[model samples]
Target: MRLTVTFFTSMLSKVVNQINISADLNCGFELACQWRNNTAGEDSGDFLITSNVRVANHFNIIPSRNNSDELFAYTHGPFDGMQKATLISNTISCQLGGGTLTFWYYRTGDSATLEVCVRQPPGSLNTADLRCFPVFPKNYAHQWLFNAVEFPPLTQPFEVVFLV
Candidate 1:
């Protein structure tokens, strides 16, 4: 099960720039599996940050949306059962109003799942408090697909989590 995530966009005035997964600012992944940035080598890794051209050539899939260069990916392996990668974003201020979070994704293989979740206070430990949107790919996707989730207004800061 391999999942690739492209750029993330927020329809908010404060978040004007597109979030880059390659940069270490807001993105983070679990260390239990192999995770790499800017490379698609399958030697031994869980998550990967690679370019659209590189992944397209490697996985025989279409290029990312808008021909974007950077991508965040998670590759599957024999030991993938119960293994997951959690990509966490930096705190987002939602004082004005909650907005939609949109991104393009490409996935291949079976027996894997992807989820989008939001946590308030940024460091909350309670899983029950998370508002999650789960995406189950019934068929393997060969092209990029669009997804968006709308969140309600919140006075406190929150962080978005991508679990795979």
Candidate 2:
């Protein structure tokens, strides 16, 4: 018996920016993953960051207290009730530079608002300095969304926060 193999060539192209994060632990992390958010303020995505496990048949973000740093995600019922999942690394600070804010999201509830913002520390999240964008719910599959905000270079250290 003889087995023959056929060779075919295909090309895939994508554009990506490189971001380097440095922490006190003397370790750094690469910023990856597409960014998206709530269009109507009440929708979310459920995928394990490590295992890469996603809830295919239903929609729900399970609460995890296991990891000290986790992503806090919430989803509505039948889809799984709204519960807070540990969104790793809540307090993230970055060197202020003019860039865009991006994320991955899943919307599985009725029309609602998704809130994303850049906040200042030692102040109320609702204050004027907060930059908030509203995303609408139209799909349930994993989707990536992004918003470009003109940010001036930072002269001092500040915190970057995202809320859904």
Candidate 3:
């Protein structure tokens, strides 16, 4: 499946002054992928950081919601099958009431699918343990769409995983 995912956190305004801190500490911070290209001889570890992705004859350019140049993307390859690609966020320590996760996604092709999941214990990727949110994206292709999922108060640090 070919999927492009972009994330923006409204909570960034709370700690804008502490931009140097790791995102894990801020809980609510912009999530951008580190520069990597699967087709350029780099480690194609499930996901890649890119600004643009082309599908068939349609080219999609994803402008960062955080005012950055690049967004994270999952490209389709010849080997695509039941294989899954995941993009996991840093551990988030929510406040007393928790918060909402908002992001933009662009999907192309008939088989493309995306899911937002919350996992406790941070590093666990076990499918059975994932608490997936029922947030689904619209069926429109070639255009970016917005989606938000609200989470309850979390006493322990947890991670949000974007599975495609």
TM-score to native of every candidate shown: 0.60, 0.39, 0.63
Prediction 3 global C-alpha lDDT: 0.51
What's the true lDDT of residue 15 in model 1?
A: 28
Model 1 stretches astray by more than 4 angstroms: 1-46, 52-58, 65-81, 137-139
Report lDDT (CA) for all predictions: 0.50, 0.33, 0.51
Q: What does candidate 2's lDDT look like per residue over 1-164, in tens digits?
A: 11111001100112122224523211111222322222223334322233122444543332233433433333322323342211212223455566544433445444334454555541233447665555454553433333333445554444343333
Worst 10 residues of 1 by lDDT: 31-40
Count of backbone collisions in candidate 1: 2
Residue-level lDDT tens digits of model 1 in 21-79 = 31323222222211122121312324443443244345654345466444344444432
Candidate 3 accuracy as TM-score: 0.63
- TM-score (C-alpha) between model 1 and the true structure: 0.60
Best by TM-score: 3
- Residue clash pairs of candidate 1: 34-46, 38-49
Per-residue CA lDDT of model 3 for 31-80, tens digit only, reads 53222122222224355445555655555555645465644444454224
- RMSD of candidates 1 onward, in order: 8.6, 14.8, 7.0
- Which candidate do you rate higher for TM-score, 1 or 3? 3
